[model samples]
Target: MDLKIFSTLPILLLLYLLDCGSAQSPPPRGCESSLESVYFNLCDLNAVWGVVLEAIAAVGIVITLILIVVLLCIIPFIQDKRKKASVAIQWIFLNSTLGIFGLTFAFIIKFDQRTCPTRLFLWGVLFSISFSCLLAHAWRLQRLVRTGEGPSTCKMIGLVLVLTLVQVIIAVEYLVLTTVRLNNVCSYENKDFVMLLIYVMFLMALTFILSTFTFCGHYRKWKKHGAHIFVTMFFSIAIWVVWIVMFVRGNAELNKSPDWDDPTLSIALVANGWVFILFYILPELRHITCPAKKEDDPPENIASSQRNPGLKGVDNQVFFLEESNRGIALNFEDNLHSPSYRGPSPMGRNVYSSPQEFTIPRPHTRPSYHPTPLLQDPYLNYHNRQTTF
Candidate 1:
């Protein structure tokens, strides 16, 4: 027992010395509680900007998912062929908006070699895609307002892709220039980033200018679409201006510019994503997918117009220019059954309006049927032919 006690004392004393040694050593940086801690950076409670941007990103993602689902649901019920064709452009535009929201998280995270390349590439590319979609839509609206005909679905999508491709090329070129040739993947200044985005800025400017023409065209009905685009571009331009100012010159004045960069970008991305959804996507869907109320329709007739498409109300108006021949659909036969669909029959005397007037009932047809037994008499000659009158 005495020998065992002596041996155990030495082992216990050695363990005590080891613990003291560990206690005297220095601890790691104050990053143990955050995800960025692993990278030796601040996050969560350690960084206010990071926390705020993270929360905004989460909300933006949820809203984006909801908008996507709503847009998908609305696609099938669009009866206008031209409007249905426009759905493809809306899809690309929405996808770009979602990418904008998702990329905000990348900005919120700590910048490093792995993320720097992606940030540089996607920042310009995604913005370009969004702006390009707006530009293509502006072009389509311009054409529709002028000639009452918009281009085909393939053409609109192709235009957006072509415009976006230029920015993709620019992004690739600039990324290689900074990350490879300069060997400064994570060391580029805000000015370098801003300079690379010049092409995207031009797209924004072009879209804004083109949207103004929506009111210049003869078709006043389509002015609403133009107004939606104009408002979206207006707010987007403001966001860009404020961010670009802060990202380039405003931060430098404050001395700790690097700390403000992520916040600026993250806020811009989130605000713009919401703007696109609230201003353009929702209103565009409401107008293009649902029937607009005509001011001329009586309260009683409103329900009837919705129940039947053949009724010659605003729903039956030649509002959408059919893409088949880029002209109005000539089937006025659908309007023949509506009792109140009558208008001054200029075509009764003019041959040019013959197709529209031919369906109007002859002046004497209604008078012949009510008082006379001709409608009920089975032996009446050619009764089947006379009933059609």
Candidate 2:
């Protein structure tokens, strides 16, 4: 989940400052102002942020890749394979790779000092957003498994379909932009303006659409399940909103003469990357399993356990019959003991062992007599002699 989303904040600020530097008129040092613009004023600061962001993002990329490799390492060992888990893992890799590409391209944009690379920027954004969607899908899968049946399967399918359409549309736009740039129709200025508008609109539309679905799904699931889904959806929506809003505002600032001294836009983008990990990816890290407690065992069989609990049988009657046949008596040795048995099928009466079955053994009598204390008493000597006769 710690995918260097927040780690790139300083870099994002530096980039935003760079963008703003281009938009605004130079500082009023007049004719004496150095030929080197404010953009390059702190040559060291830009390079420092660049190196730091690159290093952090690179580390994140490496970590994410390592995590993916680790997951893949043991995938073959799963006795009964989970197709959903496999799908989730594949998406995780795609998400991480896309994220790495975005960070790399962001560095490229910074180092090159040009906004003409629309395709890279656009694809970077698309990949970043796609990562979020994939993460949410993984979360949904977990929720579905945990709660048995999730809220309307139809809704989940619909949301994924919409996201797929958005991705396809964005991909087509990327192709078109790439083609346009190839034909030389879009120069540095036109590409920046056109690409900015397109990117903002695309992101806004995506954010709004996704927000609708996320909220609806969360709301429906919340009512059925609990507050967990609501919190998750809220954070997810917040991330989208923050990104879209900052993107739009940044574009607006750019259009209004270009000297917007703000770092919100870069922060927003970096935040978008991290927020997905926080809200969606983090939740899928662990799965819900049945609780482990000794008291969770069935009341009837708690005492039968040897400190360590074990499942006896599914059917109580079967368990009782097996125990009785094996000569294990279920008597009221303590107040905690319940002589009463609650089997799957209710019996008409309580049965006890026969007294004759406890008689003393005799050479001329039954060989398998279960001797009792009464037969060993001195008072039973007369009876023993009588019986010998």
Candidate 3:
């Protein structure tokens, strides 16, 4: 019994020593500590990548603001006779730009109950508004070119509002559901949030189809606007595809940290916003601001025509000469007597009147005579006798 107790004592002492060694050692590093300790805030300036994203977001916001200002400044000078009707589209575009700017805020600020809702709601609604505007624009172009009829500006605005309202409904439903189930925590799994994008995807698809049809149908008449819509849609689709893949699939394998999701979204917002600006907004702005070239006449011809209204008659005469089958001589001296002439110009200038008085000759009138054969012979004989003498 004594020997057994002595052996058990050493085993117990060894166990105690092991426990002491573990307690003296530092705590094991947690996943949160390792990943989150590096970032002091949402956009940690200490990290290079975070700094890059923040800078990009900041610059994007600034550019978006500038675009808004430019749009406002150029509204009066748009030179489009339909500027009143088109103002809705411009305002929608500005709203979209503002949405893009808002999206960056989601990344720049730390995630919380408030910001989470903003990130989720604004992203869906703002994007919907923008693409809805595109859809409206494309639809209008299609109808105008195909049927020579279009909706009124108010109807167009209504259409856009209806389209965007659908998205608003979807977002609200999502937020409400999330709030009820998650105890008012705005946090959502990326996959679930992405699923909410189904409606957005639908809007995008519709925009693409409408834009493609518009582009194909009116390529001849509305080449610039059609191409702009087509290219912008195509570019947006590419960006969406790439970012969706990265955010949903690639991030799991490639992301070095768990906090990369916001950055990914922020990057996408900036890139997609710039794409819209570069492809759609910038081109439209340029088209709006720049004066269109007149293909009918040269600048000098236009200037001369404006300066001298009398030359218009000469042009008309030249056109008439070119059209006529028979050659017609124009007499400058008799031009004042011509049917086309007025007594004097409004400016009191005697354009083609001659100073000298002239008269036209008339044919003389005479009685007709009939002669018999004897008279004709006598006359001929007398003429012959005189000639012989």
Candidate 4:
């Protein structure tokens, strides 16, 4: 009876294993007929989110191309010293815009052996180039306002290139190692790529710090520039925070279904790219394109002229009348004691005594007037009687 019981235990264990396997059977594979089913399957190109992402990326590419063309066309016409100083920054902006274009492609295209390296490598390098350029601009503004000297264009370009090259090297190593370990195939789990984004975060942090430093003092001379940089960096920080939270924490919690990972990244790339364009690139473009203000007339003079319109009009009329009557010459000796000359006139008591009178040629069409002196005037006899009244 003991031997029979031991034999029966093996049969019982087999039956239990079969029951568990049957209960935990995998679901059916292949596409479902329902519209909701089609939308949820991220791998399907027909997915509504995928279509929206593609449209957003296409629009970004179009806008970026238009900006690039506009920038190139206006290069020769940008004459403002500040705008000229930002030439390198504008070039980097174009490159960064293109990089964003490439990044969007990575999301639009299905993740595969062909696109993984493009996505991983370009992401860090491009963002580094852009933010480093911004840092250089902030540094230039700080130096100009604080020290009254800005870095040369070559130095600015070199700084950006050097900083960007470091990111390039990092991205290259990351890609090479990742690919080699994956046996030359580009397959990678999303978690593995998260580590590579650390380099981009460092660049963003550095840019934010530089922008913060730009606002340290009054910086009255660079107030506008500082304000733009501060606002841009603030927005960038907020964007990065939200995206990082969504990608790292939010995605994990929501990964039970077909992964929304690609869409999250796509949204981040599109949203951040637009933010940079609107806040940073658009403002710089506007500065370059807008006409420079004339400094010949001081603001005080302008404000005074605006405040005293009647005085300004009278002064202008007097100046033009004097100019138009330049050909007429008149003696002023007889008018010295006239009633119109009560005390001294505000127009200048000795207006006729100016040396400019010697240079004025008597016009042939006009006759010169020479009045007798007040001592010889017939009105002199009546002057005491007229004043007595």
lDDT of 4 by residue, 32-138 (tens): 43433323333354466666766777788888888888888888888766667777677777769767865876766666667777888887887788788888888
How many steric overlaps are in each model, in order? 0, 4, 0, 0
| Best-to-worst lDDT order | 1, 4, 3, 2
**Measured by TM-score, how close is model 1 to the native structure?**
0.67
Per-residue C-alpha lDDT of model 3 across residues 165-214, encoded as one tens digit per residue: 99899888988887789777566677777887888888888988887776
Clashes of 3: 0
- Can you tell me which runs of candidate 4 are displaced by over 4 Å? 1-46, 184-187, 216-221, 256-258, 291-389
Per-residue C-alpha lDDT of model 2 across residues 118-176, encoded as one tens digit per residue: 44355445553554444345445444443323334345445545644565575556557
Off by over 4 Å in 3: 1-43, 147-149, 217-221, 255-257, 292-389
Error of 4 at 154 (Å): 0.7
Q: What residue pairs are clashing in model 3?
A: none
For candidate 1, write residues 227-332 as lDDT tens digits: 9999999999999999999999998898868888888888999899889988998889888876534643432354455567576754433332122112112223
Best by lDDT: 1
Q: Give the TM-score of candidate 4.
A: 0.62
TM-score to native of every candidate shown: 0.67, 0.43, 0.63, 0.62
